[model samples]
Target chain A: MTVTTPRGFRAAGVAAGLKSSGKPDVALVVNDGPSDVAAAVFTTNRCKANPVLWSEQVMADRSARAVVLNSGGANCYTGPAGFQTTHASAELVAQQLGFGAIDVVVCSTGLIGETLDRDALNAGIEAAAAKLSADGGVSAAEAIMTTDTHSKQVVREGRGYTIGGMAKGAGMLAPALATMLVVVTTDAAIDAETADRALRTATRETFDRLDSDGCMSTNDTVLLMCSGASGETPDADEFTSLLTEACHDLAQQLLRDAEGSEHDIEIQVVNAATEDDALVVGRAIARSNLFKTAVYGKDPNWGRILAAVGTTDAVFEPSALDVAFNGVWICRGGEPGEPRDTVDLSGREVTVTVDLKAGRQSATIWTNDLTHAYVHENSAYST
Target chain B: MTVTTPRGFRAAGVAAGLKSSGKPDVALVVNDGPSDVAAAVFTTNRCKANPVLWSEQVMADRSARAVVLNSGGANCYTGPAGFQTTHASAELVAQQLGFGAIDVVVCSTGLIGETLDRDALNAGIEAAAAKLSADGGVSAAEAIMTTDTHSKQVVREGRGYTIGGMAKGAGMLAPALATMLVVVTTDAAIDAETADRALRTATRETFDRLDSDGCMSTNDTVLLMCSGASGETPDADEFTSLLTEACHDLAQQLLRDAEGSEHDIEIQVVNAATEDDALVVGRAIARSNLFKTAVYGKDPNWGRILAAVGTTDAVFEPSALDVAFNGVWICRGGEPGEPRDTVDLSGREVTVTVDLKAGRQSATIWTNDLTHAYVHENSAYST
Candidate 1:
């Protein structure tokens, strides 16, 4: 299941030599809709990519008919020329689809600050438009991958509507409204208001909970397009749940495929004074290099975990905190508990639970361990 | 020249069996002064070691006769027993020197959340006291090291005054007046107010600017003691300059000897709206994992640098930013300039300069590349 699983959507992917590896690097998704309702979230980073800045304008009217993405270079910090490139790409897509240029959305991901191969991208867009089909979702997903080892696609069916989505991100992942490029399609007869509400809520709980490397990207974008192909309209709450589920499914895939990560960690901060406190504390622990490295070593170093949490301004007694790695409690009341060696962390998934014991609120943050592979991949990413 | 280079000070270091390697793990610095005025700064991290908590009280009175330090275990989060251990260590030093226990400062650094070897430290205190000498600064400096490859010592001689200091920190360095354990002994005839003012000002521009791993240490302590042995009083501004020089010398040494780092990086944020803005932007770039990893790979990834600076709330026009690596302008006015491959990073030191063009203020932050060794050493640190 992928973006095309939803009715009234067509997708295509093509290789135009933008990637040195000669892999598919351009993807196109179109909404053949009775209603072109759309919403998008962009990177909070101030240094917005050219495409990001362009897409912001496209989504300002809350309507779009197409999305074009390429994964070879992030046209960020490329000055005026980069913005013009994005504009030209959108106009080209609009011309091929016989739609208004303002309705075409564009997303780009790869190394930042480099000018994209405009000719390759232009040819790829024409090729993708020519091959557009309802079953091209998988190819579209594959084309958006950079360091991702696999394509991420998900679909959820409600009573009379369906939500489908795809995501591509491996590193420079952190939290906000977005982390990477994600496209969701739905045929639920939702309006722009409903789509915006559902997408924001969905991303906050799913994509925004993953802090893989604590690095924010300039090209992060999440777009939601409603084609309204389903004759029966779904309830707002029901549609939101379906969208959230689809996003969560794709987020899990992204976490699993995160580059150079040996362990996918779930940091649960429980019993915090508030939900924000829980999330903040969880994020702090998730971003700690010391804590991540300890997890990579498969060492139940809960001390590093507590030390990380201690850096947060969360409401908790230093002597009342408890930490557990996997299922073994390694720290209780801020002191040593069970023998650390007794805990097993040989698996790919590790759970670190922290009990602040300050209140009943809780939150969970997903992260990847800092490993040699992580260093290697990031260090040589552009090379 | 080190802590003992200043007149009216005696220092010693001895093996305490606290370290598994059986190296010198305990150090003592005494102020044989007509004036025992002192000042200090502790870790800004909320999760402070017991020794830091104890030393804060010692500095509150603005008078101290000695400072005792032991490396191997950071007595943090060890509950009441940890505080007792710190108190006992200070009392032991005071008893050996025949002074008030309240007049003794204590500093501990090593693995966090573990009970230190109290007996070993006590014995080491006795041994160090017996060996105290005017030429024991080097030994004291060597003893305070945890993962440091060498002792960090510096002495700055001024007109009728001299400032000597020693620092030990190989990792978990960040800002807020302190980053590691530093003891500065000055023969300048300065009062307690002068000592406190000079220490804060010096550290703010020196130790506070070194952000090795963005991990703030729980045991970071910087202490300055004035013995008033150089009977000739020096100008307050002149003594501050000398103290700042000594601190900068030690800070540079810490950067060079940072644990597992391959390159020492200097990030200068120029033309900021304020000094604080410059420091924040510099620190943001310095703490970026993607940027650090790119440095380790010897790749001039200016986009990562801009992306990092974008995360801060600094005042700057995104399109007007300029970034240079190793004196080669790779990005000018937010666009590509010189070829990235033209930059050379074959040396141990690398410099990244960013011109924000927001104002006239500027700041520089020192960091280290994120290498495999850094991840490995930190991963297996406790084990």
Candidate 2:
């Protein structure tokens, strides 16, 4: 199941020599709806890419007809010429689809500080527009991948509607967003305000919690579009829950397929004074290179975990904290407890639970261990 | 040169079965002074080691007779018993030196979450006191090393006095201090207040600006002890400058020997609205794993550098930023400028200069590249 699983949506992917590999590098998704509604979130990074600068304007009116994304060139930090490229790409898509250029959103991923071949991108967009179909969602998901090992897609059913999503990200994943491009499509009768609220809530609980690495990217974007073809006005809470579930599923897929990652570690910080405190502690542990490498080594090194936790201002007594690895309490009251050898970390999945001993609030952050492969993959090439 | 290089200071390093390899694991530096004035800085991390917790109290009175340090066990997170070990070590050193236990400072570094062998540590301290000599500086420096490949020592001559310092740290180097133990001795006639102010000023400009791997330790300590034996009370400014110079030399040595590092990167953020803004931006870039890996790859990837700069709230227009690798202006006005191929990163040293174009303030941070050896060394075994 993919974005096209929702009704009144068409998507297509094509190659136009934009990538040296000659692979599919351009994707287009169009919403033919009785009511066109859209919402989006972008990277908090101040260095916005040219396409992000363009798409933020298109989303200002809370309505969009289509989204075009490409890989192989991010078109960021390329000055005025880069802005012109993004403008012309949106204009070409609008002209072909009989819509105003202001209603077209664009996204790009790959090398930054480089320009895209205008003719190649235009030809790919033209070909994608001609091939748009209900069954083309998979190709669209594949087209936007840069270093992802596989395409990620998820679908969920609401009361009487459907929600579908696709995402691509392999590295540079951190809080406030990762180096990801996500698109969610729905076949429900929802207003733009409801769509915006649901999208923010869903992402806040899902995509924002996946911190594969401590690096944030400059071109992260997540877009949600609604088409009222299903003729079902689902409850707002019900729609939001399903949307969150879909996003969570896609986030897990991205985490599992993160570049060169061997172990997927989930850090759960519980009993904090506030949800924000829990998140702060969890993220601190998630971003610790020492703790990540210890996990990769399969060593139950609770010391590194506490060292990371100590770096945060979250409410917790250093002497009263507790830590568990795979359900074994390796550290209790901030001292050695159960034998560390009792904890096994050979599997691909690892869980680190921390008790802040402050309150009842809690949060969880997903991260990957630092492995040799990760360093090799990151240092051997540019992405 | 080391702490013993200063007149009126005696140092010794000895082994007493504390280390499995039988390498020296304990060191003692005694200040025989007309004035026993002392000032120190400990790790800002809340989860401090037992020795740091004890030494913080020792420095509260701004006076110390001697400093005793050990390697092989950090003596952190070991509960009350760890605290007892630290107190006992200080007591033994005080007893042998015929001083009050409260006047002795203790420091430890190595594995965390474990207790040191008290008997072995006590025996080593006894032997160190018996063997104390003026030329023991090199051996004392060697005794405090954990992952350090070699000892780091520096000597500076002021107007009429000499300052000698020794530091030990290889990994977990970050702002506010690293997993380092440093002791600075001077035979100048300075008061406790001057020592405190100069120590803070010197460390802030040197050790506090190094973010080797962005991991702060729980046992970091930097102690400055004045003997007042040289009988020359130089200008405070002159003393601070010399102390800063010595710390800078030691900081550079630590950077060059960072665990598994292949490149030493110096990030300079200039023209910020405030010095704090410059520091925040510089530290952000220094901690960016993508930028570090790019440097390791020797691919003048200016985009990664810009991405890191974009994450900071420091005053600057993203479109007006400029970046340089070494001396090559690879990105100017946020666009490609000089050809990147003209830049050379084959050397061990790399300088990344970012002009924020916000104001007149500037700051610099030192970091190391992320390499496969870093991952291997960090993951292959527990430290």
Candidate number achieving the greatest DockQ relative to the actual structure? 2
- For every prediction, compared with the true complex, DockQ reads 0.60, 0.64
Q: Compute each candidate's TM-score over C-alphas.
A: 0.97, 0.98
Q: Model 1: number of clashes?
A: 0
> Which residue pairs come into collision in candidate 2?
none
- Write candidate 2's Cα lDDT for A1-383 as tens digits: 99999999999989878888998999999999987899999988899999999999999999999999998888889999999999999999999999999999999987888888888999999999999999999999999887787899999988778998899887443211246999999999899999999999999999899887777777889999999889999989989899999999998998888766778998999999999999998988888888887888898889888999999998899999999999999999999999999999999999999999999999999999988777666666663
- Give the number of the best model, judged by lDDT: 2
User: Cα miss at A372, model 2 (Å)?
Assistant: 1.1
| Model 1 per-residue lDDT tens digits across residues B160-267 | 878899998864432111238899998888888888998999999999999887776778889999999999688888888888888999889888887667899999
lDDT against the true structure, per candidate, is 0.87, 0.89
lDDT of 2 by residue, B32-134 (tens): 9988999999999998999999999999999999999998888999999999999999999999999999999999987788778999899999999999999
Per-residue error for A10 in candidate 1, Å, reads 0.9
